[model samples]
Target chain A: MLSIQNLHVQVEEKEILKGINLEVKPGELHVIMGRNGTGKSTLANVLAGRDKYTVPQGNITFNNESLLDKTPEDRACSGLFLSFQYPVAIPGVNNMYFLKAAVNAIRKSRGQDEMDAIDFLAMVREKLKEVALDESFIHRPVNDGFSGGEKKRNEILQMITLEPQLSILDETDSGLDIDALKIVAQGVNDYRSPERSFILITHYQRILNYMQPDFVHVLMNGKLVKSGTMELANELEEKGYSWIEKELTAAD
Target chain B: MENEIIKKSIAEEYKYGFETKVAQDTFPPGLDEGVIRALSDIKGEPEWLLEWRLKAYHHWLNMKEPTWAKVHYPPIDYQSISYYSAPKKKTLNSLDEVDPEILDTYNKLGIPLDEQKMLAGVAVDAVFDSVSVATTFKDTLKKAGVIFCSFSEAVKDHPELVQKYLGSVVPYTDNFYATLNSAVFSDGSFVYIPKGVRCPMELSTYFRINAANTGQFERTLIVADEGSHVSYLEGCTAPMRDENQLHAAVVELVALGNAEIKYSTVQNWYPGDKEGKGGIYNFVTKRGACRGDKSKISWTQVETGSAITWKYPSCILQGNDSVGEFYSVALTNNFQQADTGTKMIHLGKNTKSTIISKGISAGKGQQTYRGEVKIMKSAENSRNFSQCDSILIGDECGAHTFPYIDVRNSTAQMEHEATTSNIGEDQLFYCNQRGISTEDAVSLIVNGFCKEVFKELPMEFAVEAQKLMEVSLEGAVG
Candidate 1:
């Protein structure tokens, strides 16, 4: 469903992602693990079409179409979703209202009939239960004064509602407690289907226990240094990233 | 050659020059006591009203235009423009008899003047140029001990009330524009809520400037007696014109002890074109006074129009424990300029006031926040809180803040906070990464910046203000 060939990205004139190549087929769960400032989030941002990052030397294709030329919203309409590390607080915009606008925007781009408020509300109610969020959350301003756990759960809620073909979860488990992590993982697990794919980016290996990944890629200093199966997550968790750093330095 | 320069300057006045073809009754351009007398005579006003206009005219002549505001403009040629112009229509005794052309004009301006449908619960006093065209829901309002009508009609029917409150809070010499408004001011709305009476519905007035070579001068007065409460709304829009038309209006509100008055203004006058051609010069003076203990007054405004807008709706807390508030969202795009804020004067014991201002400047527009908070010695234990935020969309635009805080009473507590920031590429990218467009992201961030003020508006108006923000910030994002 997604392919990145030699992706080299720069933000503010500083190269953040260098020579990244990855591929994910439908129904595949790929996990990217890295230390802080190792370009894990940068790859997610590039895939989501953030404008601040310049793809200096790379081509990204989603479902056989070049993704670099599309806007973020266009990418979303093409079924690409990003779960932000820190959700934005859009004050004065009701959560339900924003969700409706997002849904309508994407639906309009796809030439589908828009969902009315009543139907949209009914649709979101079922998704909210999957995330265990209260109905009152729909009436409040989006993420305004929301707790950290609530923000992460709200991100998952959006991922569920949009039902994107490819979902990128960037640091979704960073601030979550044990309960929140399980709930977030449950939300992600429920949406796993043969036609959909996910790229989970995280700093820890604990989230992999809840929703196992088909492939685990270790990123270091803007490049992927290692790729393996779910066992690689446990290996790294036991030995830590210093071993990876040593391996890279020795190879250099 | 000087005539060419003057004509160029005059053409530059109106930024929006979209005209609506309609016939109007306009007097020859000039201002004097004779002009004022002719205005009263044309309306068939009572002799007392004629005397009152003459008095105000004499006082206005002796007063000078104020220059204290942080605004600079060419000197107004008050004597060179007509002050009174009303569309030539049959004297309609009812809404059904109103002229279709005038009704079409209002419809074009988004004001459905139909009495039975569009304006069902809304009591509308439609002011076209210099005259009141129609007032709906008067009978309904009268049944609730509320009086809503045009200022001219108030002068005739409720002469005693008009005589008692006219110039009470904002006298003729209050300021430059107020002085000019006092002299040869055509017409506006006047509302009165009887003592202990709560108005049933919102009272609204739509003002439109339709005549060419004429400056619109309207005066609005709203008084809520003791234990009474009322919410009043005013909106203004002008047809596209090439010449910068002058709009100098004066609005005064009086709230007696235990009364509350909420005044809101949505000003969408014709802002000049992209290059800053002709537009409305909206210079207005609005003030409210809390005259009794425990009274309250609030002002909320959404200003998205005008080539140059200069206004500061203020409040004076005179009664013990009285409260005052001002919430505003001002946007200036293209070549538009706006210098607006509010003043709160605490004169009573335990008085309180709050001011929240949000300013958005896009393109080459200039937006400023000028406000003042004064706590007198008599205002023991008074409190004040002020928050001002400015967001700039482009590098060429400018945002300024000038806050004056005066606290004479050591026991009074006052806090002021201000922030100025541009829409950073990082924030935009962040929203974009979340699948929101750049325009929607800008609107979201701007709305967040104005959330502190938007929450102060009533429920329905809060929604309206958000939509207004979206409209004002159109095409502002890359």
Candidate 2:
């Protein structure tokens, strides 16, 4: 469903993502693990079409269509979703209203009838339960004054509601308590199907313990250095990315 | 379909341009004692009122046009404009008898004169050019012990009330525009809520500028008696013209002991095109006086259309424990310029005030927020809080803030906060990833910025104000 070939990216003339090559087929769960500043977040941002990351070379394709040329919104309508590392707090915009607008925009692009307010509310309420978010959160401003755990859960709630074809969860487990993490993982696990795919980007393997991945990739120095089964996550957790860095240095 | 499209295009081009072709009684273009006398005589004012007009006329001659505002335009040709113009031989007894051309102008402006289409139980006083064309629900208001009519009619019928509160808050020499408005003002709504009476419905006045080469100067005075409450709304629009028209208006409110008055304005004048050729220059002075113990006054406005707008609706808290508030959302697009905010003067013990202002500048427009908060020596333990935020759509436009705070009492607590920022690329990108368009994202962010102020409006008006913001910010993003 998603393919990247030698994705070279930069920010302010400094290379961030150096020749990243990855592919995720339908129903596959791929996890990318890296230390802080090892280009984990930069890769997610590039896939989501953030403007700050300059793509120097290479190409990305989604569903056999060129994804690099599409706008971020067009990418979203094409069934791509990015759970931000830090959710933005938009004061005065109700979370429900934002969700409705987003859903309608995607649905309209897909030639579906827009949902009415009542139906939209009903639909989001069921999704909120999956993430253990309270109904009161719907009426409040999006993420304004929200606690750290609440913000992460809210992101998962949106991911559930959007039901994207390729979902990229960037640090969704950070700042979440044990219960919140389980709920977030449950929301992600429930959405796992043969027709949908996900890319989990995180530093810790704690969340991987809840929902296992089909494949694990270690990113270091703007490049994916190794790939293996879920057991690689436990190996990296025991021996940190320093071992991976040494391996890359020696291989070079 | 062709006609509908043409009409829609016209509506979009000149949102407020509709003319009334009534035979108008206009004086020669000039400003002098003779013009004041002519206006006074035309209204058949009593002796004392005529004397008041003459006094104001002389006081206006010595005063200079105010230059402190951030608005700059060519000096008004006061000498080449008529001071009085009224529909000829029109003794308007009912809305049906109002001139068709005048009614059409109102219809085009989206103010239906037909009572059936208006908000249920609410009243409207429609003013075209320089006179009140029709005032609905007057009888019902009178039954509730409310005196709602034109200022000219009030001068003749309720002289004592008009004289007592006309310039009580904003005197003749208060400022340059007020002085001019006090001198040659034609007509405006006069509202008097009796003691302990809560007004049953919202009182609104719609002011339209129609005649060519004419300046609109109207004065509004609303007094809420002891323990009474009232909410007054003012709306203004003008036709599309290549020459900027001068509009100088004065509005004053008086709230006695335990009374409250809320004033709102939705100003949609003809904002000049991209090149800034012609539009209305709206210069207005609005103030409210909290005269007795525990009185309160608040001002809210949404300004979206104008070439140059210079107005500051203010409050004077002279009563112990009185409260004052000002919530504003000023938007400027396509060469529009607005310098607006408020003033709060605390004179009595333990008075309080709050101010929230939001300025949105897009499409080469310039917007500025200017305000003042002053606490006098008598105001012991007075408190104030102010927050001003500005959002710039494009790099070409400018956003500015000028705040003045003065506290004479040592016990006064005053706090002011302000922020100026452009829409960040990250915020846009975040929304874009949610499948929302860039334009919708801008609208959402701008709406969030002004939500603090927009929520203060009434429910219906809050929705209208949101749509107005979207329209004002159109074509602002690349």
Candidate 3:
């Protein structure tokens, strides 16, 4: 469903991602683990069509179409979702209203009619249950005054509500507690289907204990150095990323 | 690329810019005692009113236009602006006798003059240029002991009420522009709710400036008697002109014991072109007086147009336990500049006031929120709470706040909060990633920022205000 070929990205005239290549098929889950400043979040943002990052080399394709010229909204309407590392706090916009706008905008782009308020509310309530958020959240401003765990759970709630074809979860589990992490993973697991895929970008391996992944890759210096199964995640958890850096140095 | 889009959006044309073609009785461009006398004579005013106009005219000659506001414009050529311009229709006993061109103009502005086609609960008084052309639901209002008519009609038919309440809140000698407005003010609306009677419907006045090179000076006075209630609304718009047209209006409101008066305004005058060539110079004075114990007054305004807007609708809480409230949403785009807020003067014991102001600046627009809350020594145990917030859309725009607070009574409690923020790229990207367009995102964020003030508006006006915000911030994303 998604392909990235030797993608090179830069921000503020400094290269952040150099010659990174990745591929994911339908229904597959890919976990990219890296330390700080290793371009894990950069790859997720570049895929979501954030304009601040410039792509100077190679290409990225989604559903067999080049995504370089598509706007962020266009990319979103084409079934791409990015769970931001830090959710923005829109002070007075109700979460329900914002979600309805998003849902209707995507539905309109797909040549479908808008979802009525009644039906949308019903769907949102059900999705809230999956993320363990109560009805009070719908009335509050979008992410304003939300705790770290609540924000992560809200991202997962959005992922469930949008039902995107490919979702990039950028550090969604970084600040979550054990209970919140399980709830977020449960929401993701319940929403997974044969035609949906996810790229979970995180700095910890704790969340992997709740949800299984098809592939685990270690990202270092903007490149995917190693790719393996869940056992590699367990190995990295037992020994931190420093061992991987030592291995890369010995290989060089 | 983003800057180009922002420029394109801010360049959106003013929608209410079409002129009305009508034969007008316009005075030649000049301002003097003779012109004021001629204006009063043309209106067939009583001798006392004419003398009052002369008094205000003499006072205006001594007063200089104040320039402390954070706005820049060339000096106004007061001598070059015609003081009076009205459609040449002499007398109108009914809507049938009104000029079709004037009626067509109002109809095109979405205000149907015919009673049956108007909004269900809104009684409208349509003022064209310098005269009140038509007033609807007069008989219905009269049956409820409510006197709703033009200022001139009130002067002729209900002179006692007019003389009692006119200038009671904001006198003719209030300020420079107000003094000028009093001298040659042509026509506006007057509403009076009798003692213990609640107004049955919404009272609204629509002011339209159609004539070229003419200044529009209208006076509006509303009085809510003891135990009465009323909701009044004012709307204004002007045709596009090459030279800046002047609009100086004065509105005074009075609420007696247990009376509640709600005043709302949606000001959408022509805000000039992209380069700010021509538009309305709106300098208005609006004030309300709580004259008896337990009286309440609220001022809600949504201002989105005019090349330069200088207004501060104020309230004087003179009655013990009286309440005053001000809610405003001012949006400035293109080259528009607005310096507006409200003032609350607490003069009675246990009086309270609340102010919520929201300002949005886009393009090269500049906006300021200047508010004042004063608690006098006599206002023992008074309280005031104020919140002022501003949001800037583009890099070139500016937002400023100047809040003046003076509390002489130690028992008084005052709270003030202010914030300034930009529509950051991250917020826009977050909305875009959710499948919403940048334009829609801008509207959403701005409407959210203005939610507090918009909630204070009437339902219909609230919806119109939201749509106006969307139009004003059309492509303001950066």
Best by lDDT: 3
Per-residue lDDT, model 2, residue B136, is 84
Alpha-carbon shift of residue B402 in model 3 (angstroms):
0.8
Q: How many Å off is the CA of B170 in candidate 3?
A: 1.6
In candidate 2, the residue pairs with backbone N, CA or C atoms under 3 Å apart (3 or more residues apart, or in different chains) clash, namely: B17-B239
- Candidate number that wins on lDDT, 1 or 3: 3
Give the Å error, residue B454, model 1.
Answer: 4.2
Give per-model TM-scores. 0.91, 0.94, 0.99
Residues B131-246 of candidate 3 have per-residue lDDT tens digits of 99899988899899899888999999999998887777878888999999989999999998999999999999999999999999999999999999999988888998889999
Worst 10 contiguous positions by lDDT, candidate 1 chain A? A88-97
RMSD of each: 5.0, 4.2, 1.1
User: Which candidate would rank higher by lDDT, 2 or 3?
Assistant: 3
Query: Worst ten-residue run, lDDT, model 2 chain B?
Result: B2-11
Candidate 3 chain B weakest ten by summed lDDT: B1-10
Best by TM-score: 3
Output the lDDT of residue B20, model 3.
86
What C-alpha lDDT does candidate 3 achieve relative to the native structure? Answer: 0.91
